[model samples]
Target chain A: MSVAMPPGSAFLPLSVSLRGARLVYDDLLLFDGLDLELVGGSLTCLLGPSGIGKSSLLRLLAGLAPRGMSGHLHDGSGQSLRHQVAYMAQQDLLLPWLSVLDNVLLGSRLRGEPPDRSRALDLLARVGLTEVAHSRPAALSGGMRQRAALARTLMEQRPLVLMDEPFSGLDALTRLRLQDLAAELLAGCTVLLVTHDPLEALRLGEHILVMNGRPATLSALPELPGAPPRDPGDPALQAAYRAILRQLDAGSR
Target chain B: MKARLWRALLTLAGLLLVWQGVVMLGDLPPYIMPDPLAVGVRLWRDAGLLLGHAAVTALEIVLGMLLGTVLGVLSALALGYSRRARRWLLPVLIASQAVPVFALAPLLVLWLGYGMGSKIAMAMLVIYFPVTANFYDGLRHTPGGWLDLARVMAPEGRRWAVLWHIAIPAALPAFGSGLRVAAAVAPIGAVLGEWVGASAGLGYLMLQANSRMQIDLLFAALLVLAVLAVGLYFLVDAGLRRLLPWHPANPATLENG
Candidate 1:
């Protein structure tokens, strides 16, 4: 089931622009002078080999300062994008002590705001986790925990969402199902998803960027035909999967 | 559960047998070593007296734990929430542990007087370190991912909310460990204070019985103190397990039977 958009304010779909971004750690440059733009209301998949700075780029955009990283991240209106962005990492990062429903409302509670319990339940129901809403995170399966995390990310009602391998730990079938769910739920928001799986990029990315080299640069791949939650078996998707593999392999040297 | 109870009973019986064997084989007099049965009889005969002293010691232990835990938790929060507080208080927290608390028993008794006040103070001093150290470590090491999520979710000015909602709850299992250690060792401080100078408590009774050569009564008091320590530890352990239902106990360590 598709998630209902949160009430009161519709998302403004903020477009993010990163210009002349430089990241250095321990005198080793990870990326320098990187320019990237995330078009509003589209899903962008970032694929790169291990330690290639894709997550660092995503973190930079999310306004999380990686030490020694210099960057300018702003929406087009000269305002900061930090308040409009929500982040989801590989680990679900759910508080084991909190009930699943409580975990969904963690953002509100942390912000010292009165939680919208009804909207939280609506998000949970859309994720098909209504039954386990009252259970602790430890009691849920891996897939279920990630679903709850997805619900939590949506609960922020942000215009831009950044996810770093959010489904990498799950089994194959669960990952596919979550990709479809996330696509439906995050239909109109700007999403930058960092993933290792090529097929996942094919299935969900409207625009795919492959990051390569020592001081990494993002090279945009040819846009996939049609919208996301695309059929994995489609000939176009299979062709794109091979192209991504080749691009990643060429960069590994 | 039944199997575990039976195993514990058997272990106690085995230890009693060893005690009885040692007494009989040494042909020791009551002054030197009383049999377990003799101590048991003394325990029955002096039940009221023993209970009175036991009640005093128990009060000191419980109150000390309450005060120590509260102080430790507050200190941990202060250290975690403010960088300035951490810089100033951390050295003092470390130095508090550097000086052996046992060395201060006489000083505590002198300062607080030869009453329950000194004993409770001693108990609180004994437990304060472990509760503070373990909890502070836990707070310092809250999983980075959770903190990152909190940063994005909450506003920058509301950093304390992250510490309260995320870091504090995450640190509870460690705090529980500290509390368990506190319960086990809290009796030591109370008894040590009583040993140095006190008119009441099991420690005082034991000292009196020792002076009079009432070795069996001394043995009875010792046994009661042992029971008190064990009982208090288990109580804290059980309460902690109940409080942190989410902290999974190791199945291998759990009493499955």
Candidate 2:
């Protein structure tokens, strides 16, 4: 059930444009004067090497950007952003003490909704985790935990989701399954994903932004060519991956 | 399982043998180092009176634990969320503990008189520290991701519900440890207060028996105190396991899960 948008509140669409964003830490510039836009209802993946501020950019967008950063996001709709965003951190961040179902229902609990246990159950089933709903994160395999985290992110009914290497530690098959699941659930929302894998960026991202350090900046933003839930072997994905890799390799040199 | 049971039995036998050997070798006198069997016999003979005293002590311990837990949680919540309160109150709490229970016991007895009141007060004091520290630390260390989730999830309304539903459950493990530590230390405080001055209780009984050179009875009382402490600790531990059944320590099987 969609909650009534608060009175005198503005609703920010899924689109986000970062104008002249910069961030610094301890006299070191993580990102400087970066400009980017994530079109509404699309998945944008930030792909780059380690220490390239990909995650830092995601953090900035989440409004949790650490001290010493300035950025303004211009949503297509003139309304200010509401609290319609969910974040999946680098770690699974599942409460180890809670069952998988309970963890998924956590967002509902925090939202003061009568924990939609059925939503949690359905999300678990979508991730092929119905059998493990009552299991703890610690008891489940790594992939299962990630799936649970994904379920939690989706259960929030947010319009925007930020994922930081959400599938980093999973095996290839598990990663593919989760990638599909994410695309399905977030069909109508925007996603900002940060990852190091070109394949992951190509597999899931509609727009790919490659970043680099030493005055971190976006090296490339390749427009992917495919429909929703693109296949791995799509010709456009291969072309985009190759083009993005050249920019990344050229930047490293 | 067999190995653990065997190890436990061996350890018990070893302890029993050491006690017997000590009594035989010391042979100083029955009034001083009574044999384990003599201690057991004395315990059996006075079981009725000892049980009565034990019941009172147990009641004081349970009540004090409940009171101390409530105080600890309230103080932890206040201190954890408020920086100014933490700065002022935390030091006072530490300083309070520095004045050892033994030194304060007599004063407590004089103030409250020789009743259960002084013992419960002592127990509350002893149990308060671990509970406060552990709970406060837990609340302070709740994962940042969860808080962020709460903010995003409840932007429209119901802030308190978010904190209680998200933050409190996240801190349960630390809360469990705090209570367990507090429960373990609680009995010691009660016994110490009883020692200072009491007309009844196992601690008082031990003092009386010791003064009369009934060493076996004193030992019996000491054993009962140890058992009570262990029992209380395990009871809290069991409760923690039951509450957080999905905790890593007790991995739920597929059926239970």
Best by TM-score: 1
- DockQ winner: 1
What are the per-residue Cα lDDT tens digits for candidate 1 across B1-257?
Answer: 78889999999999999999999999999899999999999999999999999999999999998999899889988998889999999999998788999999989888999999999999999999899988988898899999889988874748778878999888988888888899999999899989999999999999999999999999999999999999999888878888887877623236432
Task: In angstroms, give how far residue B17 of model 1 lies from its true place.
Answer: 1.1
**Global lDDT of model 2:** 0.80
Please give, for residues B1-257, the per-residue lDDT of candidate 2 as tens digits.
Answer: 58767998899789989999998987758887888899889889999988888888898899889999999999988887678988999899888878876688889999999999999999988888899989888888888877765665666656567557766776777888899889888998899989999988889998998898888888988888877888898788878888987555443343355
- Candidate 1 residue runs with Cα over 4 Å from true position: A2-9, B250-257
Which pairs clash (backbone N, Cα, C closer than 3 Å) in model 1? B1-B257
Q: What does the interface RMSD come to for each candidate?
A: 0.9, 2.1
The top-ranked prediction according to lDDT is: 1
In angstroms, how far off is B100's CA in candidate 2? 2.2
Given candidate 2, what's the lDDT at residue A19?
82
Candidate 2 TM-score, C-alpha based:
0.90
Weakest ten-residue segment in model 2 chain B by summed lDDT = B247-256
lDDT of 1 by residue, A117-192 (tens): 9989998999999999999998899999999999999999999899999999999899999998898888888899
